[model samples]
Target: MGIVLNQSLKNTIITYIGFGIGGISTIFLFPYILGKTFYGLSNYILSCANVIMPLFAIGMQNTLVKFYSQCKTDEEESRFLSFTVLFPLLLSVPLILIGLLFFDDIAYFLTKKNAIVKDFIWLIPFIGLCMAYFEIFYAWARVHMHSVFGNFIKEVGLRFVSLLGLLAIYFKWITIVEFIYFTAVIYFLAFLVTMLYAFRIKKPVFQFVIPSNVKEILIYTFYIILSGSVANLLLDGDKIMLNQYMAIGNIAFYSVATYIALVISVPSRAMHQIVYPITAKLMHNNQHDELNDLYKKTSINLQIVGGFVMLCIFVNIEQLYEMIPKEYSGGILVVFMIGISKYFDLILGNNNAIIFNTKYYRAVLFLGVLLVLLTVGLNMIFIPIYGILGSAFATLLSITLYSLAKLMFVVKRLHLYPFTAQTLYSIALTIVLFLLFYFWQFPFHPIIAIGLKSILVTISYVYLNYKLVISKEINQVIDNVLKKLKIG
Candidate 1:
């Protein structure tokens, strides 16, 4: 728990800093500098790359995390690492060949609704391949319990570089076309840096022979491929589908709102970097009691952090939208729909780590397949009628359904739950904070109003959570901070 707290807190701060830069780029700079069309085009390209990344990696990222800790000796670890490292290239080679063989057909299919996408179609696979290896090496780093550095690169370095690229466009130092191409360069550079860092963390000892548990490793990787693809599809499918159904510019508008909502999930993302490997180790050791305690603690701590962010976003959404261009403001509803759904997703703690690491993961993969179909079906039915809002609705429905299913499976199969009295208390407090400050907008500029309201809500929320002791882990951190400042 001490290590979890230290690392999670560090990761949380880093993730928020990244989100801060990303917020400027997404909410203000991109829309103002590039206009909605180019902004959408840029985001659409990245979204396509993200959707296919899991396939290119062939689930090696998760396979490494799940099995690395179970190896008995350095020799066994070397064999496992060697195979996982090369497995993705085996899958990606055929994919690359096929992509080239059917290049024109694939390009035509993608650009039918939005011809602007035609020029950048080739970059998708290139960027996806880069992202896949980045995660593969990131997992290699995580298995050694060295996640903070990799996390900084993923969370901060990428966004910071992209900010420079966006500023280049603003200063007319580069054309939007150049900016788009440069974005791929950014991903490739980040990938190379992460790979180097991975080797630095644990110099790879390549033993290409099959591991003793090759059969189990292969089976788990196969199931993980399905599960990982399903997760990415659910997360990124909306933006991709929007390009298909509406004008490309609508994706820009939707991306703004989605990014705002995604800020609420930062804690989960930060914590999961450390928690995933830890959960795998715990499960491998069959430490059920500690695992159960971790489940509850993670759920509460994430709920505390995510709930505070969600409340701030939901309460201040109207004022926040005032800063953005009017054309993009329609996503206010999109923010709420997606924001609440993400909160639900967050409170599940390390539910994903639990499911993906356990044997029952195969069953969850089945559920993931169904939810992917449901998400697509919902988008198909809703988008034509509702446009981007409909896309948000489909995401909300799919994510909620998926979160509920994962929660149930973990409880039924593993006899573990992430909820307790503190869970409900946190929910109630979140609602109260929203109702209290949401309507209390200041009679000032949007920025000033947001600043004051955020302070009030944050102070009130933190004070109450501390008094009620909603999370002992968080309370401990608070106490430590107070002691360091000599204010307790």
Candidate 2:
């Protein structure tokens, strides 16, 4: 328990540092350095590969993590690693060949009236393959319990390279098309680095024996692929659909707002990645009470983290929008919708992971598909009428409904609930603070105004927790840390 909590703290520290670097790259650098269209193109290419990579990888990644942890011997773990990589490769070859064969048709479908961009299509499989293996190798690392390196490589390393790519665009050294192609290379390089690191940490071997039979694994992968696809679609589906119904230009604006609001959701995501496998291990051992404790503590901790971020953006939104083009500010509504949707999920803590790792895992796949249909259904009904806001609402509805359904399912099956009295207290405190700060009419410089607003908000949240909801363990943890540093 101590080790898990420590790992969670270390990973949270690392994820935030990585996100700080990534925030500059996406929020500031992309808009400041590169033109919106080029950023849009770069975003599109990555989104495309994300959709393709999950399916092409054929769910090998999740299978690797779930099975590798269950494997009883080093030999079995080695075999599973090799075996996971094989299916993605085999599936990818035909996918690559098909894209090459029907290049023109594919281009026509994707680009329509726009000039043929199939040259960038080749980069898809190259990237798709790299992404496939990155997940496989990352799973390899995670099961080895070296979660930090793989996470950094995926989230931060790729973002770092893409940052440089945007810088090149800013300088006009590369055309929009060339920049998109470069994204594929960046993903491949990230994967290569992980593979090299894996070799340093442990040996990789190809063996035939894995935890489950090959037939059973293949069957499992087939099901989990949609689970992966639906999950990514919940994030990436909008961009793809936006491209289909609206102009490519629209994607740039939507992406910008999405990127800003997305910054607020990172803490929740970072915590989830660290907490997921631990929840699975606990469930495997029948530790329901421990799992429930984790669910509650993590929910409160993440709300403190995520709620603060959301409030910062909610308060500073007008100023944040001032950084981008006027047209992009249209994403303001989408930002709110997406922000709430994301925070709601964040507040759910490890509910999704608990369900995904349990005997009820297949239920998640059905839920994922349902989310896609809901997103698309709402997009169809709303995009023409409201454009980005409609998509925002549609996506919000999708995420909200999905979260509610999952929350209900987990409550019924696992008998867990993240929405404690503490959650209500946090919400009430945050709202009251926001109203006071927004209406107070501070007569000061904007920088001072911002600083004062932030301080007041923080103080208000602490007061609420102190008066009504501070957990004993959190206080104990704080005292121990202070003591270790010789502080009063």
Estimate the TM-score of every prediction.
Answer: 0.98, 0.92
Q: Write the per-residue lDDT of candidate 2 for residues 55-141, one digit (tens) a residue.
A: 788888777766666777777767777778775777777877788899888888888633434456566667777898888777767
lDDT of each: 0.92, 0.76
**Highest TM-score model number:** 1
Instruction: Residues 167-241, candidate 1: write the lDDT tens digits.
Output: 998889999899999999999998999999998887888767877778898899899889888998998999999
User: What TM-score would you give candidate 2 relative to the actual structure?
Assistant: 0.92
Could you report the Cα RMSD, in angstroms, for every candidate shown?
1.1, 2.4
In model 2, the clashing pairs are: none
How many residue pairs clash in model 2? 0
Q: Which stretches of candidate 2 lie over 4 Å from their true place?
A: 171-176, 208-212, 439-449, 481-488
